[model samples]
Target: MKITQTRDIRAANRWEIMHQVLEHSPISRVEICRRTGLNKATVSTIVKEWIDKGLLAETELGKSGGGRKPILLQPLHQAGAAVALEIDISQVQAILTDLSGERVLAREQFPTLGESFPQVYHKVCQALDKLLAEMPPSPYGLVGIGVAVHGVVDLSGMIRFIPRLGWRNIDLRSLLEERYHVPVSLDNDGNLAALAQQNLEQASLGPEGQGSEALPQSLAVVNVGDSISTGLITNGEVFRGFHGFANAIGHHTINLDEPVQCSCGKYGCWEQYCSNGAVIAYANTVLPQPISTLEELITLIRHQDPLARQVMDRFLTYLAVGLTNIIFIFDCQAIAISSELLSALPYYLPEVMRKMVLPITHVEKVVLSRLGKSGAILGAASQAVFQFFQDTAHAMEPGQ
Candidate 1:
């Protein structure tokens, strides 16, 4: 009867819905229908399948409808729990997020400097224990942990070099695995930032949304801090050039001023013009007194210090000159900014766009990251999960 026909339509609709839900769960069937343009009967059928498969659980019971109650669906932690760890020179931050990237608990932050590798590792374990104590048990359990830090980490988890952290060739992956007894993933901080933004919003960079799909996918993740770099994502992956030397735009030779030396043993790398270090350097020259941080400059700007104003304008101009080539080359639909710099995007974003040679319509596409540091941790976590999934997918064959 009508029930059988409803099921058929719903079955097909559910498949479509699940694909979308895999990326964005915790949504109501109503939103799913609007997103996929399907009827309620179809949504219900698919939701039931997801519910039966244990991939979803009921989060809320809405008011009684025309017949039955409305239930809000959330993706179960089927893909399992993931631990995201960011190792900074000054602090370490960790978070545990479900498959859908919803942080299930409060993040744990710890000091990083002067601690032995074993000591720092154990503190992370203790933090995980504290977070899991209040949660209900799940089926998939903890699948993996992702760690991101400054430096070169080979696929093997060896930290080749981290100048800021003052570490060289440390065996980080093996050490973490020994303690956590879970799969560990390590990536550069910039790469993780790009992954975080990708999950938050689809880039209009490609043809399906903004331009031609035939073009190679691309990303520019500008992170401003004590250390800075842009992580490039291309063709649905991080474009680590032969030997992983891509996206080091921070050292692209953007300046030639004297007494300006980059850590890479060069004069006027892009970092000298667009990084926090650059701002601080300029603030000292312009103002009667040197400013310690970007926050101090912001405050100075508010007080109408002519020095702050000039420095801000100069930063914007340099950033513009650096990114214009990005648009021409990557044809990037979005240029994501992360870390503490995101909060200041509203102030300097327009100026950054104005400096571009392109039209206002094109420049208006400058995209700021939706998630801040949260993206960094989650990006690492997602990397671990995807790596696991790929391995699993490869191991299973259709005939087998």
Candidate 2:
């Protein structure tokens, strides 16, 4: 028991040291010790171990504070890589990123609308094959693959259901892992988007303010695409509730009089009124000509068409209603709306705020998501890199 405890502690220390280096490289051993509160000996020993393991590299000397110029350290980013995939109802997009989650290759994608699981699977595999072939040479090669699916994903990575695609009980993780021979993480698109947004917020803090305490302890991300879903971050962690379905706020009923039913078998759900599809559908009903896409609706609104303006006004009203409910329930530090249409219109936010019956403080908390459509994609890649470090840490023992 004592031996095992010692090993666990050692592994934890290694993880901490490595995390600090990855976040603030090229950082010095002395700076790491100062920031992490780890002793000089522990930091130096772990740094040496990682350097010897080919995961870390010592770079040029940093600026001198006083006596001696300290040698800076950086992660060997090319030592490993991760693949991130975003499985949308209409398409599948994939990107290759380094150990630091930096893009290593151009984005690859293929359409998957109305395709069967087998067809989608084959296309995904082909895309992966092309990506792998073009991957730069590395020591660890592909460390893991992270997938973002729009649906209810369980703790074990089982996709319980995807309402948009009619996919149910798919073990995508196991299938991908079996074929690729690497770790596969499957998560809800909203959850992954929230994760990516949180990381971006943390990174914006810079080195001195990069820790969790410096950022909001609770935040929420509302993803508005074909449908509406939400991701919550509580105490600086993704809040996947007991059943891994905590933040499915799209299904939350916001209207009782509406006749339209949601995919989840409910009337007047939030998504039915506030999603991009909802906006376009409503626009088509009110406009002279039918509009099939959000882009068309946006163009009409840009031209100051009276019907388009009316549709957007109603959309904003419903959007504010749902957002107000979210704020009342979660009381997050900030609520980020991830939508192409919403982000494109700078005036929509103020309009939404005007419609919401909330205090000035609450109104200030609402803002647009900086990540846009790439949130889930980048989140998947970051998750893979995170898992790799975690596994690497736990695998460390007394010696090789």
Candidate 3:
């Protein structure tokens, strides 16, 4: 038991050291020790082991502190790579990124409209094959694959349902692991987007001494596209709830009098009123030419068309209502919205804020997502990279 405990402690130390290096590369071992609260001896030993293992590389000298310049350490980011995929109703997009989440190859995508599950699976496999073929030489090769699905994904990586695609009970993780021979992570697209946004905000905080304000401990990411979904971060971690179905905020009933039924067979779901499809559907009713895409409605609004503006105002109002409800339930310090329509017309953000009236909830805390459409894709890659490090740390156990 003592031996096992010692090994676990060592493995945790190694993870801590590696995490510091990965997040703030070109850092000195002394700084790592300070940041991780590990002794100089332990930090030095682990750093030496990783350097010898080709996981870390000593780079040029850092600034001197009234002494010899300290050698900086950086992760060999290309030592491994991860594949991230976003499977949406209309499209499937994939990207291969290094351990640091830097894109190693151009993005690949294929439309999935009306495609069967088997067909989509085959195309996803083909996309992965193409990416692997183009991957640069690496020590660890492909470390893992992360998938973002537009549906309810349980903690065990089982996709429970995807209303848009009519998919149910798919074990995507096992299938990918069987074929790729690597760790596989499957999660809801909204949850992954929230993870990505959180990482971005944390990264922006910079090194320890930059004096940037700390990120909000609680945050929410709302992804409004074909449908509306929400990712919640509570106390600085993704809140998956009991069944990992916490992201189904879109299905929440917002209007009791709504005559039109939502895809989930509900009346006046939050998504039915706030999603991009909802905006387009409403626009087609009043516009003479019947816009099929959100872009068309946005263009009409940009041109100051009265009908388009009316539709947009209604959309924003409904959006605010849902957001107000979210704030009431979660009390998040901030809310980030991921929507192409919102990102394109940022001026409307204030209008959304204006419509939301709650004394306890500060509407000003609501903001547009900086990651935008790439949130889920990058988040998926980030998840894989994180899992890679965790697995690597666990491999430090004795006899394995």
Please name the candidate that would achieve the greatest lDDT relative to the true structure. Answer: 3
The C-alpha stretches of model 3 lying farther than 4 A from their native spots are 1-4, 209-211
Ranking 2 against 3 by lDDT, winner? 3
Off by over 4 Å in 1: 1-19, 26-53, 57-74, 113-136, 155-157, 203-217, 339-342, 357-364, 385-400
C-alpha RMSD for every candidate:
7.5, 2.5, 2.0
Candidate 2: segments with Cα more than 4 A from true spot = 1-4, 210-214, 359-364
Order by TM-score, highest first: 3, 2, 1
Give the per-residue Cα lDDT of candidate 3 at 299. Answer: 90
Alpha carbon lDDT of residue 377, candidate 1?
A: 72
Candidate 3: worst-modelled 10 consecutive residues by lDDT: 205-214
Candidate lDDT scores, in order, read 0.67, 0.85, 0.87
Tell me the tens digit of each residue's lDDT in model 1 across 1-400. Answer: 3535543444445555764555555567876787788888968876776677566677876555477776667667654677778876567888877755455555788887767666776887787776556434676667677887755665556776665555777877887788768788888777788877766555333312334433225667776665666677777677666766455566777666657567666787776777776678878989898778888888887787887888888887877877886666566756777636436546777777778787543532566677765666778977766554434333332232
Candidate 3 lDDT, tens digit per residue, 1-400?
Answer: 3536777888888888988887778899999988888999999999987888789999999888798999999999889899999998789999999888756565789999888899999999999999998888999999999999887888888999887788889998999999999999889989999988887776676566343556877899999987778999987688988998989899999999999877777898998888877788888888899878888888988999999999989998999899899888888788999988889899999999989878865633788999898898888998898888877777866686
Candidate 1 lDDT (Cα, 0 to 1)? 0.67
Model 2, 37-133: lDDT tens per residue?
9999999999998898899999999989699899999999889889999898789998988888856575689998788888999999999988898
